[model samples]
Target chain A: MDFERLYRDHADTVFGYLAFKLQDRQIAEDLVQETFLAAYHGLEQLEGVQSPKAWLLAIAHNKLVDFLRRSRNQDLPLHPESLEAASSSAPSKLHMQEILEQLAEPERTIVYGLYVEGLTCRELGEILGLPEGTVKSKAHYARRRLYQWLQEGSAV
Target chain B: MSSEEYKELAWGLVYGTLSAEERELALHLVSQDPEFLEALKMELELKQRLAHLKRAMPEEAKERVYAAITGSRSQVLVTAVLKTVLETTLPRMLWPVLQILERSVFAGEQQ
Candidate 1:
């Protein structure tokens, strides 16, 4: 599937997503391997899928969640410290990061793509492999959840 | 319809995801409810803020992935381990069974 080129093109975006979500460079790198390995393995199945980037992001999301779960061994709250780097000196941005942590992974990715990648929801939908309508719904859920987190003091 | 009930689909609406019928309702709600409109605005803003956090992978990362991809070391390591396991463990596992069967056959012959 021209994997080297595909990896070259989207590795930054995938790494970006993992870095923010994981807040760990080492873990992010390891997971990137797993992500590519997974993508490499599943490339055949995903050939007809709408968005390989989004599909890879989904794998990354799962890997992140699994990593978090392993670390916490519970449905713990966001690693509060992870937000420190992103949020320091910018309270609103931190709030946004906190709010982001409250979102489900799909919602988070759609939000991340929308906010970070500057992709429209339709574009995000293409990447996420969801219908645009579904992608929008997730994006909205993410937004509302973030707002709720802020209003409720980043309640987990 | 109240914004609360509509939130299940709010992502779509915020992202202009409404179906023909739903769009009418969502637009009407947007006009009627300032709070709901504000929420949508915030969502968009939050998306922008989150976007600003993008990070580039450092150079070393590229090298690591490249090495892992091209070096063939891991493949070699895995194949070696598999061969060792098959050659050593497979015989060990079969030895007891083979011994028992040999004893049975030879003992019957002696009888």
Candidate 2:
């Protein structure tokens, strides 16, 4: 596989997904390196995968899960404040991000994967290891939760 | 279905993820209820707001990543550390956390 080409093609997507998940630019940047490094070493296994972008995303997803688990073990909480702190006040982006940070997991992941990354319910199901129906249900609930956040001007 | 359930269905309609039968239910409800229409509008607006958050990877981070891929490990590690140190505008509260993060990273590298 052409590693340079893969990095050029999918790095933004991977980085974006990580930044959304981990909500830290610095950490997301570091994890992007690990994700691509793992991809480089695992290129042989990727030959049969149909969507290399999704494949890269799944790698990024796992890297994030592992990173979070490790951080948890080390007693390092992932701070929504830090995510906000890292960014300048780009209002719409900040508003969307603050609401997303308010959302519970799986829901945050669901809505973000759907709207931000433009992943379909089927694709999200595959990445998240849920059935498509379950993914759709999560999307529904996530939107309601988002709407509620909008109405409240704060998330519950 | 309950009103809350219908609102959720409205979300499915707005997101285009509803099955045909689900879409039928949602449209039926949507045609009847002003609340459902409002919900659909809100969902669409939320989607638009999310679209605004799109950001490309920065050049420095991109170079550090590619450097790691090409086996310039030590050089990129130094760059990362130097960048962190030289970055003068980081919020005061984030500094200690960044130090902890660096320690964890270096600790992982050693093992």
Candidate 3:
């Protein structure tokens, strides 16, 4: 299945999504390997599938969730420099991250998929196992929620 | 439509996912509705802020993953070779030696 090609194509996007979701670079790195290994083993199933990128993303997302579940239900830790960013400069960046951390599961994933990963609604739906309409609706809700939180200066 | 509905429309506009008709409606709202404009502004700001959070994969991490992929293939090859030797050759070759060693060790202990 030309694993090298697949890795070269999707590795960065997968890693970026994981980093954004987990907010932990080290853990994201480990999970990236695991995700690729899983994909390699499942190559037969992936043959002729629509949207292979979403397929890879779905695997990465599941890996991230499984890791979170095993890790004692830990909250998403802020970035290491979050405090420094908050105090020294780039408070808005830290603030946005904190707000993202507070978002519920699908919403947070939705927002990350939409804005950060630049996934289309169809791709997002495929990765999330939701219908396209549902993805769009969730994206709408997530966008509204984020906007509302930013407007209120508090987590929604 | 209600303000909340307009806000949802505003989201579609900002995301560039709105249909042509929907975009027209949203644009009209943006022109006339202060809340919708504020919502649009917030959406744009959020996108910009979130852009700051997009991180590239560290180079070391990329190297580590590539190494792991290569290592996994190597491990599979080694396992297959070891399995072939163990299943077909090692049991016959080692059984007699193992039995002899076992007898020698336990024989002295019993004595």
TM-score of each: 0.54, 0.64, 0.65
Give the docking tier of candidate 1.
Answer: acceptable
lDDT of 2 at B40: 75
**What are the per-residue Cα lDDT tens digits for candidate 1 across B56-83?**
7777887688578645547757867975
Q: Give all candidate RMSDs, comma-separated.
A: 10.5, 13.2, 7.9
Candidates' C-alpha lDDT: 0.69, 0.78, 0.77
How would you encode candidate 3's per-residue C-alpha lDDT over A27-80 as one tens digit per residue? 778899999999988888778787778899999988977887877576645454
Candidate 3 chain A: worst 10 consecutive residues by lDDT? Answer: A80-89
Residue-pair clashes per prediction, in order, are 8, 0, 0
Q: Which ranges of candidate 3 are over 4 A from the true structure?
A: A73-89, A149-156, B1-44, B77-111
Query: Model 2, range A39-126, lDDT digits (tens) per residue?
Result: 9878887888777887888888888888988998999766556556546687656667677877787988888887777677777877
The DockQ figures for the candidates are 0.33, 0.33, 0.36
Pick by lDDT: 1 or 3, better one: 3
Quote the true-contact fraction of every model: 0.65, 0.67, 0.57
TM-score of chain A of each: 0.62, 0.80, 0.75
TM-score-based ranking, best first? 3, 2, 1
